[model samples]
Target: METSAQGITPPAAVYEIAGRRFEVGARGFADAVAEAHAAHQRPRCMCLVVGVEMYVARLGGGYIVKRMPGTGSHHAPDCPSYEPPAEFSGLGQVLGSAIIEDPAAGETTLKLDFPLTKMPGRSTIPPTGSEGDSVSSTGTRLSLRGLLHYLWDQAELTRWHPGFAGKRTWATVRRHLLHAAEHKIARGEALLARLYVPEPFSIEERDAINSRRLAQWQSAVPSPGKPQQLMLLICEVKEIVPARYGCKAIVKHIPDQAFAIDERLYRRLGRRFEAELALWGASDDVHMVMIATFGVCSAGLPAIHELSLMPVTAQWLPIKNSFEHQLVGQLVADRRSFIKGIRYHLQGGRGLATAVLTDSGDAVMPMFIGLAEEGKLPKAEAVANAVGMGAAAAWIWRPGVGPMPPFPPMQRARSLIRCA
Candidate 1:
């Protein structure tokens, strides 16, 4: 077994394929995996004693192992495929109900509260607040922002490690987003078919890229008698500026095209995401990520219906404020492995862990950053409730109190023993 720097053995990336154990780097491992994929065999990850089942996915003519749906928490914490318990974030509020996973079929069915097809003569109601604040009446349908968070989580974009610094570019983000959309079904339509992530721009092949984009958007073009199909767009915001008639949103990598936003929707966006906009504007290193549903008009113009904005650090980890920004930066500097928590439909005042450190000791540590306003810090009860959910130990930083306390010390990697 390979040992880590601390002299403890980390969980081996081993799997049982067709009743045989194969380590990731062993000879003929690739051939064994390919054969298993061809034979329609499910591989079991040996991260735990009993091992958790995994599936093989084909990507770019290569195959990759993926965890079974809803089984992420079953693996050892240090396992590469390990995901925190759903209860750790907003995912717990909707998983298995709003989001249904079919392990046998390898698909996820999403029940969305928003409309995917709009009538020609009807106007969509302007959103009163951010998508994360919109609650479903039955508490079983996912809001637009909830969908975004789900995709981001599945893409592992919420995960951070010091090794990823300076390596997360638009191309990487887009690739992961598209991959996450695979096998996702929303509104009886494949999510991949209705999703648009801009490809990296190159002056040399600009025309080809534009052609591909236009082709992909053809399905969303307005039809005279049929309901207009709307496509979901995820991109980094370059700017939102005044257009000839109303306003337009310019996204990175799609400089030639802009998504039109009417004055009312623009105002709503400003009101809904004021904090995100402010946080993004305050730092040059920050990036504004936008997820919106839009449709192509008969005149070939793309108009947005509903949208939301999230601010991420330079490393692409989501942050709600300067305090989170500071905490994430410190974690990266210390070479920590952590998962960034996302608030789906949770209210702004509700306390949630900023990030959960996975490499700390025997149990995961949830880190909280308290915001102070008018000499008042976040409520003690709210923070306690957030911590009471699962974690035993938590690290909190109240900017109003003093400097951030020292983080929990990292523990040596432990070996995962397989059961006989």
Candidate 2:
């Protein structure tokens, strides 16, 4: 029945996040702005639901009433809204105290770790020689690849438990993520506007869905007085078929449209991400995701300047192989909060933790999974020596290790998990 200073609707009720009590929602969540748009000028209510401040986000069907996660304000550990510590994921490295949040305004300001602009006909990945003061500026930024991981992590697409079996899908992911991003403001623009996720392509919905996609790229279109700009586009990969000159990617949504890549970029993509391609091709469930920057040419073709690819599990969490998927299965069976690791800039075959598991009772665990005969045990040891910090303890598994080592029973006091 009321609007905040920004004119956004309010949540249905306030649940005290920390106290586990109903603080606000007895009447209703959202309502049509009464005829008296300016007639009611009540001071803002701080948007606090329960004890933890909550914001009204418009996503999915109409609106979702959710709270800010990991502020120790979420209702319980098992709640889908609960978040693991950033240090448990690569988030701590990229965020490095660079994000500022305003609960009252329902907005977040994030410091990025990469550049967004590129001149026409040239790549701006920054040559190694020009990487001046790289170490000093590293904390304030994220690599293009790292940014993709951060978004997936923040969207909770990485979370899984036994109860979610067969429930995840691309459409649900698109909705939850678009909603997760509703309040994120980046570089003075709505982050939702800058990030594009192609809607599922279908003959029946093609006209309606494609028409709404323009708003995502309105800034990239040429205006009479203003020049065109390039923005990011993320989509599922259909195939990277070989084209006449290089390779052409058949993106999932825009079947009628294809993005062409030059010989150089294509070779780089194939070489660096060969493992990803193998995994995608070997299974019907694996999904390949690509992120790139592009602009429309005079002829209306989308020309890509830079691109990268990653493989995610059926559930959309990033993974490298079946072994990592096995580890994800174990964690989910136990209802633990964990982070999936991505090899952004790391060397191939280097031993990095397959994933990090956060147990409510025990300390944070960095886990390694492999066949002992595959030489992964040593690799895990090497990774520990390489990135020697943050993990409370190391957990290792291999082929002959019949079942996984036991985990502490799920903590019941602060849990909200409806199923195991």
Candidate 3:
């Protein structure tokens, strides 16, 4: 059985609610949560001496604890809600500008550069090779790819630990993605309402799943003289094959369903994500994750409008190149806790941490991979600047220079699992 580090149970999560200390899973915890929600009282997570504040969110009929806005990094590294600082990744660029959080309302408003609706009789513009490479020129709007990256980050799919191996299934991923979409608004519509993440396939429940899917998709179906309402789809790509007229994307878990893609969009997709496609094709363990805006045609066919692809390891950690693949492999083998960095809207040449070592005591260590441009090594100043804000120190690995360097020393292994 999977155990935390060396099998010791970490301290149970404790919170100070309404001036009283309560442990999660303890008796009366539910009552405390309900009271806090009804009284609008924010619970403080007692992970550290000062404690980090959290908010109660209603999920279904019950409530869940969520980290407050901009407070993820303040929690202890071993805390279940710990998140690496935004400066270590492209999230720093868009946190307050493109993404705005209202702590009171518990909602996030996103300014997207892409459209959620497509007009009938109008041709969709094919994406250029550099469309999602960097933040929009205004630096205040998220690109289609940026939005996908944000969702992935918010879902905490970027985090990894040894105990999670073989447990991160489609069901787990879908649950987290849906939870992340809650209370998020894009273009004045609730993101959760517009997002569809396929449920894990179950032969016993296939018909029920299909029925729910069709019912949810009706909102996006085209009607006479009406603009096509588009919905967001996040799924694993099974294959892209030739259909009778145009190409189609066969998504995993949905065996008999496929999303149609036009010739122009298909060609552009090939050009825009050639590296990602090649990397995915090279490894059987790699998962090709696709995020797209899709709408149902008059004939009930789902057609893709704008989309982006990201390659992740079997553990679902995002990786861009062979170097990242190697780095992530070593981290997993070593059984360390870390957050994988994602390039939301940053260009390929821009410096970003590969991962942040959270198990290290006190301060987090940011790992950097130096990508040589044209035949020249990256400047030391540039790498330092990337590692400057919020990081304790830097772990540099220049693949072109030599083999991977040793990772920074980690604190003694301790269980992060806690029981109330």
Candidate 4:
């Protein structure tokens, strides 16, 4: 929530911050964010953070610029970013640690602990050992699962309450993800440019959507004998029913369209993400999210090149078990603002907390779900240290150990951060 009162850089034409008018070029926006200047800074209408702050967002036309949302700063109780109490959630374990931001570069570096792309053509067997130990890091790159988690969190899709139940839909998820991706630049390209979240295919809009798809996929086509470029798709899986020659992934949005996964690729998915597939089969409450790199064939059919799977709650929140469901159910009822910690590489609650609550200041709350049978606490000291949250407070809940912790009091209305 820190912001500076200064001029901005490129990727922006003109902007107003705290009633001050300033103008810059295309690279101005990025330079301002990177240098911690004042490009996208706007006065806070909510939250306790002092001064105007910068945020990644899109503006008029197609320009990616910084925006300040009155409800997104996490400072005020009524803001969408506001939470119960930092001590009640595990937000402290990540903020300045695992998740990072670079405004100038328009990128957010996420430290993930799961593998995204396996060695080309390598065996797809699940690596032996506990799931908690599977930390994937060759650099700052995030695994497919990690990327999806980050996106979900960034989209604010993880913040849910019972009141939002049934109100959330694929259209809503797509809208938020697209907005979150607005000013984000990943690997030298706009994140939104590389993403594909299919729109609801309708008989009326079929021709228009198809024409757009044709234009997009045509760029991926290569010269004779040249390899085609890969495209990224984030879609909810409907069914893995059999097709003419292999398996077809029926997408929830594009019900009329299917992505082909050849026999080999299908086997790879089953072998590598057996747990995800199994979880998807176990309940209708959880759904599978797939992030796959695909290429269009000469016949215009899309085929998978590399892919990964993840299970998310019906609310699109990432969840792994009934235990999390119970915890989330209560949190939702209490209207808490918390982010679920994903076990990408780590398994069995071996690292990080169950969830983290975010607040205005630096302190974040890390919550853990302790097991009574095991009679043990989660090994989260190293996790806290890893995320630079060693000094942050924490909360642990042991089932059959009485009721959960009470929600924190709301911020006084008098403390509102009035925006000019």
Candidate 5:
């Protein structure tokens, strides 16, 4: 059972994880995971490699790949194959040879050098009127833009295969792709099949939900067979406040500060939560949320200040702690195919647009942006106040609503270099 901040308890429920079952009381599992993940220090085996053309797929709702047995490509039939839907043509083809290295893991790392297009690069899609909104990109490099959408919608591990808690690591799955590609490219390597991630989320619906629209974008529109001229920016959010039960107004009042509860005991605590949970994947969700939020911003900053109480009726599978559940969301605009500033946010660091809301009514902001980094808000009451009218802004916590002050609203007045 879930409990409201005011003491109204929902109902008790039992959930199974890795064959062991546990009971959840009103508080749920948010705090426990927060504490465990906070203390977790095993170095991760995954790393990011740009510029590789590897095959990826959502088979039977899970991510699966075929790779060479010993990472060699010379052995024929020895070279195994993993096939995705014919429609899943471009996963990630552009970028150039970039190594996804976990230097600590030695050869477990992969170098992805996806081929760029020989076709002339095209600028922004020509204005095709309202119909233009439906046009997809055409080229060889999978749209990093679309790939972001694919990666975010993946919920196979948590929602379906409960035991495989750590299966979603993008780097692990990328290695599987590298293996598959190696086998397909050469003869010595045999294509061996392995499940990348078990179960795919309802991407079409989740996307619609994230976008906050009734129309299904990925399903309704056929993927443009060619890749367009596009660039990708990898971002990492440093902190995230697990969603806690509280009044909308009260929850809004919570501050974004993440100081260690015991600084003296935990001398190594980083300045942010993502820094703290770098291995557990809190940052990826933050990035995806930001993408949806930018979609909301493009739609003119609708009434997004309402608190979200996602219903938790099942055995609450805890993503953060015994008290928290992983909540994924997105925003979209009813009109237009593109948004502004997200590319900037993806580039990272030092910009007034720390947060971006999408045209579809979603909003994205780093889980934490120190008050010192924020630009000064207008002192005038009408502009300075964080909420209601002209005070348009997106802070993890609304200023003055709870105990903390809101960060400055994003502004597009200046151009700046990214910090990534």
Candidate 6:
């Protein structure tokens, strides 16, 4: 009680995050203030630590006290030891390991922010010739500042223990970023043409990113044979920046079969895409595509690559008539069906992060999502609804022939059985 700030209410002093809260007591107030201040000072370096036992719980008119070692002790020169209650579970161990087990422990609990932001739903890619002769025909360049801003834009990292304000720990930021980059990289060749901006993402970070990306691409052993019923479409969206002339995008296409080999092929296949619009014509927008498989080809080799022949569309499954009438229930439960599919594919542990260049001079960001992996097409649409995403352009690339983009998927939803 000695450390408690006089007149400060318990409700006002405590804050919650990710299902946990920071509880400061009269005796623990001073230490909490010092810890929070120190962590805030080096926002980038701050790693969160929680003390499970310091909390008190009430149940059915009963009171329970949770206290661990070093509750009232001074900062020790040695690490403190405490056992978590059974109900406290896994997070207890995660937080405990992250705690600073120092010989001089100034605080009993430490809490850091989410550290980095989540990937933005949108991003921009620079187009060729936009630099107005500043860049060579064969040159490939990336913007360092733009990449930093993208990393900063992630909304998820706002709650991080210390905000990114003045905290310039590139090493910690990069470490956290690489973890996220792993998800994109694991998608394989379908994503190989897209560029990824991992934090602490300096030129130095390229090697690590490339190595991980390649490793992930090589690991994806495509599903044996073709999928029955609905088809699979892998899309990578890139923000476009127009060059001196205008904006142009290469919507390269990849077959489901190519996913078995290194997805890097998708990147190589970029040359096959084509555009008739004058360069720099569309510089004010971001360009992306949804490449999917269509009808069989003459060679019967899955056509290898093709574009624009057919438009993209979605079909829903049969559901009980009673459930169909419940619009709110469908909206509430079916949301995020698509994003969940992308997440499932991402978690499957294989795929590439494609790096695409825009003909537009403006900047672009790429997002990769899968349509077939999230159970079925209907669920994927649900996910798209949850995230406010719509139909995307299609990419199909081949030698001599450039990328041919198909029309965006129809926005309206259709049912498996005709609506009675």
Which ranges of candidate 3 are over 4 A from the true structure?
A: 1-11, 131-138, 372-391, 412-420
- Residues 1-420 of candidate 2 have per-residue lDDT tens digits of 111222211122333322233324343323321111123211112222223344444444454444554442133333334444443344555453455666446467766554555454455332232211111234455455655666676677776544455777777778766766777777677777777788877899987876776555666665555445777777888998788766788898788878876666676666666767888888887789888777666556666666667778777878867677667766655555555665443433444556755333223346766565665444434433433322234677765766777654443222222211
**Poorest 10 consecutive residues by lDDT, candidate 5:** 304-313
Q: Which ten residues in a row have the lowest lDDT in candidate 3?
A: 1-10
Q: lDDT per residue, candidate 6, 1-420, as tens digits?
A: 111212111111232222334343445444443453444321110011232223322222332222233231111101111111111111222223322212122122222211111122211122333221111222111122212211221111211111122452434433443332221211122112232222233465666654663443332212335321111222322322333333322222221122211123233223322221111123222122223322222232221121111111111111111211122122213221110001101111222111111110111111222233433222333323422313322121221343222211212121111110
CA error at residue 393 for candidate 6, angstroms: 44
Specify the poorest-scoring 10-residue window by lDDT in model 1.
Answer: 1-10
Error of 2 at 92 (Å): 1.1
The best candidate by TM-score is 3
How far residue 398's Cα lies from its native spot in candidate 2, in Å, is: 5.7
lDDT of 3 by residue, 233-315 (tens): 99999998778999999999999789999888888778777888888889898999988889997677899988878889988
| Candidate number that wins on lDDT, 2 or 3 | 3
TM-score of each: 0.88, 0.69, 0.90, 0.68, 0.20, 0.20
C-alpha RMSD for every candidate: 4.2, 9.4, 3.8, 8.6, 25.9, 23.4
Off by over 4 Å in 5: 1-146, 149-197, 200-345, 352-368, 374-403, 406-420
| Number of backbone clashes in candidate 5 | 78
Report the lDDT of model 4 for residue 79.
41
Candidate 2 ranges beyond 4 A from true positions: 1-14, 17-20, 23-76, 96-98, 124-137, 214-218, 222-227, 330-395, 398-411, 414-420
lDDT comparing candidate 4 with the true structure? 0.56
Candidate 4 segments exceeding 4 Å error: 1-46, 49-100, 105-135, 161-163, 333-337, 343-349, 357-365, 370-393, 398-420
Report every candidate's CA lDDT: 0.78, 0.56, 0.80, 0.56, 0.23, 0.23
Question: Which candidate ranks first by lDDT, i.e. highest?
Answer: 3
Candidate 1 per-residue lDDT, tens place, 1-420, comes to: 322333223445889998888888788788888887788789999877788999876654677778887687677666778776665576777888889987556678999998888998876754474343423424488787788888988889999865677899989999999999988899898999999999999999999999999998898998779999999999999999889999999999998899998888787777777778888899998998888889997767798888877789888888888888888888877778788988776665655678887676445677767665532233444443543323345677878779999987777434557532
- Cα RMSD for predicted model 6: 23.4
Which regions of candidate 1 fall more than 4 Å away from where they truly are?
A: 1-12, 25-27, 34-41, 57-63, 130-138, 371-392, 418-420
- Local lDDT at 104 for model 2: 46
Clashing residue pair totals per candidate (backbone < 3 A): 0, 11, 0, 31, 78, 77
